[model samples]
Target: MDNKAIATDVLAAVGGKENVTYVTHCVTRLRFNLKDSGLADRDVIEKIPGVIGVQEAGGQYQVIIGTNVGQVYDEVCRVGGFAHETAVMPDKDSVGKKSILSSMLGTIIGCIMPLIPILIGTGLGKCILMIIQLAGIASSDTSMAFYVFSFVFDAGFTFLPVFTAIAAAKHFGSNQLMAALMGCALLHPNWTSLVSAADPKFIGDMFGIPLYGMSYASSLIPAILIVWVMSKLEGFLNAKLPELVRGMLTPLITLLIMTPLSFLLLAPAMGYLAVALGDALLTIYNAGGGVVIALICFVYPWMVVTGTHSTLAIAGMQLMAQTGYDPFSRTLPLVANMSQGAAALACALRTKNKKFRSTCLSTAFTVFFAGVSEPVIYGVTLRLKRPMWAVMIGSAAGGLVAGIFALKAYTWMTPSVINVAMWIGGDGLNNLFVAIAAMVVSAIVSFIATLLIGFEDPTSDEVEEGADYQL
Candidate 1:
């Protein structure tokens, strides 16, 4: 279906555009903050042609649309005439009533969801480069091809603050350009040079406060915190200043005040918190070992349902910065995705309904190859009820093996079969073998379980017409 038609169906399912307070999308879902959640037809939305499923969680109505969500989101914005920045902001009354935890999760999702496309693209580029380097196709790391490819792949993570700050500003109702400049300040050549210096004294002082130099490259928490504060400061300044000078003066004053504060307080504080959280998670993984990993895999689908899976990305990034690799974050998720896909494929093989079978096959391919699992999970597994257990069981089996082998990813990438190449250089052949083993094991186990467990085939009404469905 065309984007406009999809948008129209989506808007109508969600009780029309008037009911929408805001709309945004992550990698595979369109998240909507509705004025009245009751007005939305959840069952109807789930059955929409392009929609994978519907989720009401984290105080938002989420429509799962697989990987094409970005295109649909753009169309939704156009059709609804809702500004992207304002679309995500909650109603004023609802804001004060939200719990601290909900507010924090919402902010994190807002800031990070916008960056997923770039993150995935750069991550895959890095993976491809690694494979080429490993194959001796690009022998010299010093070669121009190597440098160019490396920079192209590495720049996204290396300069994450710039992207994150802009997103956070939009989320927090701040000046985007000013927020972007604040991010640039964190990565400024002068600041970076001081931080790179061997001696502590080289960092000097900023406005009577000591500058404890630290690199903000690939850092998430610091950029988010800095921008949140900047938003508040900008709002205050804009309101208090005269209309004529406000545009110019608000940003200038906000930057001057925030830059010093960031260097002196925000960066250090958030950096420590991020480290502590990452360390705590690492400690838990080390202590619990395979059992913990298995449990994570078992419950992962539920996390995705609750819209809390994005939290893992934040933690994983921090862990990667602190340590050279992230073992806990991406490993089990990869297995779970493959398992979900496997279950869907099994359903495809067993189902008599040609249309439903076709959808199952397509979604299976999308999940297994592209690592987008929502379609298979929501459209098939959860819809069938029996396959979800099979997926979890298979995922747990794979997670156990992964944890026992201590499989790790050297870089931040979306966990998928395509990302298996990333395991090559850092951890040697054993880790690569383990990753492959995890995929194979999960797929086989889930396939077998789904076939044995069985599910009721969809009725005639449930089947839709479309051979070209791409999940």
Candidate 2:
């Protein structure tokens, strides 16, 4: 069926348009924030053509759409009259029912998911520049091409607060412009200059209250916190203040109140928390190194299943931002992604059933190239059972090597074969070598393990369209 048809059917199965409070998509799923999840028939939704599966997590009824999620999401917006590229005010009742963890995941995913394209592009651009400079095409790292790419890529990190604030506002159902203003407020030139000063510790006082100083450029947590406050404060002022002054005064008052509050409290608190987190990760790495990474990789696929890996991914990015080095976040996930694909490749090569082989081949490609493993996880490994074990073993084995080298990544890179270059020059030539070796070990181990474990190959009658992953 076509995207529109699939979207239309799935929307109806999920209690129609009225049941949906808000909708968004990540790389492979249509994440629906519903007024009542029970209103939707998961079975019916799963049976719909083009839907790969259904999952309820993080306060969302997620329809797995594989590679074509974007097109289907657009169709969903068009058919449901939902605004394109904007989040609606979420259902209050549904929001209240979410666990604290779920809400946090939703907010983080909402905020960070939008920025992924920029991060990926920046990493890839840097990778290409490295290739060019290495080939002697750009003379040296100080060449004009290097400077151009530096600025182009640097803009994302430098202005991250502004971007994050806008995204947080959208997630919080606040004013985007107001959120943007808050982001800008964090990175204001005056603040940047003060932060760059020699002492750079304190900004004297406001109303005799000691004002502490901290830089907000390339920040994440601070922007999210400030914008969240902006949403609440904006809402309160909008409700209580007289209508005549509501629009003009609310924004003015929100900025006036939140800006100083951020510097004096929120930003500093967030900065400390960020530092503690990075330090804690570093300490853990120091203690176990490769063993820690192996354990993480072994458990990561389950985290992906439960949709909890997002927390780690976000933490990884924060670690990189805070310390300019991430020991596991960028590296282990890369090994795990390759392991899943490799495991599925084993299944593909082992299976004689034409349809099962095709299924394995396609999901392996999707996970390896597209950087999404939901398909491989559900479509191949879980179905075969043994391949799931192979995935864990393979990724964990690769993770051991990663730990021994203590690979350090400097970007918000995702897990994928294409992104191996993002891991390059992380520490030096040795880091690149470690990345390649880890990936190779992951694939070989997963492939060999799957073959050795020997999962029961699906028979001709057992396989059907969506049979492998669509449960």
Candidate 3:
């Protein structure tokens, strides 16, 4: 019933080392791409000691493991092998494009995933800074002590392009280092100073090509394009070149053809696309902000269920950076996360089974305090149909309220209760408080709703021993 035994069972169920095509873990699940989907014994895997559940969505067989998922994933990879073992699966063509709906959801979750650890770490770091400064234990200007906490907290966002490139590359099937290098090129020192100056001439020429003065630091688009291009180039070279020459030839060709193109054409075009997309989102906001929020609220839970929320996070950040506020789309998901968390907590308390009880408790606490909702999505709401209604009711109420306030968020901050401060100082504080209040009200209201409308009995397997259910 321990993690090791559970991991062993999972390895065996998913066709063992040979069957695994590729493997990775998000906040809550061990997502795998298998050579033969039929090889996986979902029921058997679901009944494993540590696993919370098993489901196939997004073209991947996902093993739910609650909070310590990363640890289990690591073990799976170790016993499995990079290609023959846990890490062996290559990126398959089937993992290609999903519907626009799926893509949008995927982007939102992707955007938030990298940002979560950084946001929580930084927010708490800032909290520490506040405590120390308030208590005369530290000073922003004079204390070397301030720098330590400040750097740890602030470094992630500051170097977000690098972080984004890593995640995006994994998503898009490119060399992570090459993608990171491309991100580095986008964030090159010279580019930063040029963009900051806002000089028309800053958009200079690169070997007869016009340089696009876009900042890549915390920005999106350019790095994604660069990485996408990298994937194509890698694939092209791998396919055409002979195996003997591929070792040296692929990287050379990819870097030569792809890198220059990334700097000259890809980055700039994507920058333009990003700007256009942000503008488009704002246009929608200006026209029907209320309706947009209501819809997002309604479907956001489904997005969460399907691992598609990352798109929104990226789009929201891009929108916020381009225009002061991102129409009505920015804060709806925040409410959704809070609502789901609250509902899950209620379910945790309502359920008699130990597995549901543990999952609900851990997921609810983290989602409430830290604003990470994967636990609730994987462990509770998705399992019990009624709890989802609680999330929906809360999301609809919260989204409508958000739309009415027309709240504006300036920074690309995470949707945590702690992030309320970052949203306060920028632009005017018009509906910032209202947005926060709506999120809180929605959470509480939805939590109570779940209690009133209870769910079916937990499955016998869902009530297993030593589940270690924390999200």
Candidate 4:
């Protein structure tokens, strides 16, 4: 879709490359840390071709660009001569202006957003493995073929701490190598063995104090927190340490001090905090029943809109570890995502402009298959205004049905048509059917509602003035 042209327009609209401090993207949005947000034209940027929506949240300027965000991001970087390899942290001045909560949210989003592509690929690989097993093509989990694929796909999650550490290190402006080494220490075979062993002696005592040994595989909080502290320590040391000794000694001192603090203090404390939060969410889910589930589904798209949905990954991971499945992941695709796709499809059918129709169709395809809804939500529904109500209505209806049926996902995969097979073994074939039913209900409802409510057609002038229409 002329990605280079779109990138040029985006760069210009945001007040040229000089106005940008940093630029990065998630599944569907180009997140920009602007030097002066006031200088950029949000409305004009929103109207740009290929741009779906623009939001100022968490001290960042976000431009929604659908699934092609990565391609567009690459072009944006190329046009602006920005480095994609380096992490893009918010400016210190920007952080100072934001509340603690906003700053924390921004930090979490920045650290985790970079990992989405790899996570999606691995999740899909795991789904493929499940499909093979379910089809009886590979009957045994112990088969050599299974083992090979399993390790290849599972390694990402198994060593997730390392990736998180790298991202966190970049976000916090720390030594990446040292941060990665600390992550490795958390998942070291020797330490993991000690924790998994039957005898308490394997963990042994440290200065008459029993060591708390917990496997850090697939963990999020500890890796992020540890690296943050490491970054601060390294920054302090870099300023104080002699220039001649800084290179080698800084990493050495940081690792020596941070490692013990991580294992003996930070990891255990963060681990407990994760568990407590997960337990609390589960408790609320149990107590509130179908009403809570419906509400979550209705508000899920809004969460994605504000970048708060990424936080759920932590709770979803912890819940999977504890309960062998996570209902949150399952419910989202059936209701929130399906409804968004449906609304996009409605826009495509109802719109007369050929270009807008094509864009809506492509967005619908991404939402239905990839399970990313931000583009559809921001680009089409939210922009059109009335269609958003249609999506919510459809989502609430579908969520009610899913909650009533008690549909849950067995594996930790993003909810999508590709991962529908994951529902097969955990909740029986009936649950899978119910999930399908939920999707159908959401899509039909949203589509019909959008058609009924209708939206303003893009005028020739508007289309020419700005590429505001979804592409």
Candidate 5:
């Protein structure tokens, strides 16, 4: 796609390098913290070759560039003279101006989006291993393959804090090695011993203050908090200490101060919030049933648009761990993805513009196969507007059917046609049947809905795909 030319064009469209404050990329988008967001022209940027779309959310100017975004990102850095991964944090003066909601959304996406590949990989591995058991090819309890895979998913979850801490440290501009050490300290054998005790509270005293403990493996918030505090502490030490001793003492003092404080204060005080979030989702699902399921699926695309859906993806794991099967999080995303694909497929059929039609067709295939919805979302549905509503409506229809049939996902893979094996759950082929039916329903509904609610078809032969701000 001529990345060099695209990068050169992108720099000019976004007001050149002088307006760029920070820059990074996720799996599919080039993220930018702009000196003034208004200075960037979204429409102009989307027309750049190799650009899929653009989104300004979570306080960042995001240029959607598909799977090869990393290549484009490096080119962008070179063309703009912006350093790679050098403190992507927004200016401190403007940080406080963000609403609490935007701040949380920003933090979650920044820290967790980088971990999506690990989560998806582990989930699919487990799903494949489970299939071997169901096929009677392996004894889940005794087979060598089972033994190898049994802990594969758990290993990802168990050391999630370490992974998450590294991501958080990078985002918050802290030393990643120190963050990794802090994560390990949280899961230290000594701490494990204390947590395994019958009564964890007041079992040990630190300066006459009672120490309470819990297993930090598979936990999320504590690692993020510790790393953030460490960043601040390390920064202070860097400024105050002499250059010779700074490196030696910075990490040492940061770890010593943050580690115990994390266990005694952060984990003890706030770690349960993650558990509570899982419980709250469960409670809400139980109360609302199929309607709640429908709602989650319906809103999930919007969540993806803002990159907030990453949290729910992980939350699904929490649900599965607690119940041994997840009915809520994992099930409907598949439905929604197919629904998006359906809407885009309809657009491909309905559009007279051949280029836009091709764009629509490719995006539909991406969602149906690769399970990525961003191309269709930014490149098609949201641009067309009516089709987006069709996607949500279709998802609601499918989600209702799925929830009514108690369709549960046994694994954590991104919901898509290719990953249907993920539906083999406690209910066996019944859930699998339900998943198939749900996908069919979502697609048919969205396709029909899109055709019915026709959009303003692009008239230009040179129809570059996308929309940034509205239906």
Candidate 6:
């Protein structure tokens, strides 16, 4: 479809300006919150030239338009007259069951995305807190100011379930409130404390089916899937039950069916599967540390192009939480992020396209300083083949070095230059310095390579390639 036609069709499908609640973009998807998902014409929109796929995740209908997603995102906002930010609750019924890879990515993005803004805010808050505590303005041992800082910083991680439910419900196409309610089951004060206790293995059963053994804290997969199923069950009951009883019956039926099935069957199996998979991945990562890094370096940027990098990150986090350090642990992601930033900076300097240059510059700065990389890869690096190759080579080289050094990160934060704090877990500043050094080297190398080889701007034909935000 032509740009104008594509824009017009998308605007119509999302139900004119009045229906649009919010609009946002990720690596390769235009995420929209509409008054109604029913108003969207998914089939037609998916056929758009730039469209790669259509999905409803995180309570938003995402139009995947690949690498040029930002451009199309702008187009979508322009045509639809969406404000820069809008609070739109996702429809719970939007999430679709996914493959192992999809689930892994979904989980990773699920955990991190909801926590990102909080992390940023908390990071800044922690910085301030540390400064104050060190300066004697606040006592770390016993002070209200310290307590306040602790809450703000710990809130995201502590009540992660609430955030995950909101995001996962959006992904699973379920009701956010319903999903959140389900999440509350796992997060409830008594339940959480009990679950955290390492009770002996017991084959608990609901309806005579043996339940799998597991804990729920720092978990993402089970609760997410459970809520999705619950939403489906609720929908089914709503349709089957009589009008008078539907209100009570729908929820009652949903809970009755879902709670047992989930706890007794699905949740246990999924938890085991996640643990096993996470463990197996770590084994492989540890086996050929450098080689694994090389492969990630090679594929990570492309994954970003396809909007699938989150799978790797999610897998890493799940494994990390279980094992205390994921096999794919260390400075690999940091290198990748830095490489993209470097490539973006290179593009910003070399390219003359005002829009492209500006986007690249902004992305480079944010990814480098703030640790958000989607903007760099989707908005800049992946658009240029030579620059992308530079990023890949730099990433691999950096990954290899990081792997050899056996770098590790303790905290879960976005991979960025400032995220160096994450590596300060065990020993002093050794790992942190290694991470910084590797990222710097990778960025410099990628920058040099990009300047040497050069790249092409997206042609007019290529513009339509991202018409649906598939990148």
lDDT minimum window of 10 residues, candidate 1: 462-471
**lDDT of candidate 4 at residue 80, scale 0 to 100:** 92
| Better structure of 1 and 6 per lDDT | 1
- Candidate 5 weakest ten by summed lDDT: 462-471
Residue lDDT tens for model 3, 164-274: 777667766667787777777777777787788876235777778776666666666677657766777787889999999998988888888876687678777777788
Per-residue lDDT over 345-434 for candidate 5, one digit per residue giving the tens place of the 0 to 100 score: 898888887878778888888889888788788778887777889999999999999988778887767788888888886745888999
Q: What does candidate 1's lDDT look like per residue over 359-461, in tens digits?
A: 8988888887888878777778887899998998999989998888888887777778777876765645788898899889988999999999999998757
Cα displacement (angstroms), candidate 5, residue 86, comes to 5.3
lDDT per residue, candidate 6, 120-214, as tens digits?
A: 56645654565466467776577977897777676655565666767666654456777777777766776555555645245455477655556
User: Residue 381 in model 5: shift from native, Å?
Assistant: 2.3
Model 4 lDDT per residue over 248-312, tens place: 89988887898778888898788778778878988887787677878887887777777667677
**Per-model lDDT:** 0.81, 0.81, 0.70, 0.78, 0.78, 0.66
Report the candidate with higher TM-score, 1 versus 6.
1
TM-scores, each model vs. reference: 0.92, 0.94, 0.78, 0.90, 0.89, 0.72
Instruction: Give the per-residue lDDT of model 2 (tens digit) for 1-471.
Output: 489998899899999999887788887888888888889998888778787778877767788888788899999999999986467776566667778877777777778777877877887777777667667678435587678777898787788888898888877788998789878877888878887783556778877888777777777888898888888898899889999878789878887898789888898788778767878988898899899999999988787776667678777877777777678688767888899999998988888888888888888898888788888887889767878899999999999998988877766667677766677664357887888899899999999999999899888766775663531
Which is superior by lDDT, 3 or 5?
Answer: 5
Residue 292 error for model 5, in Å? Answer: 1.4
Q: Best candidate, TM-score-wise? A: 2
Q: lDDT of candidate 1 vs native? A: 0.81
Instruction: Sum up the clashes in candidate 1.
Output: 1
lDDT of 6 at 171: 52
Candidates 2 and 6, the one with greater TM-score: 2
Q: Lowest-lDDT window of 10 residues in candidate 4?
A: 462-471
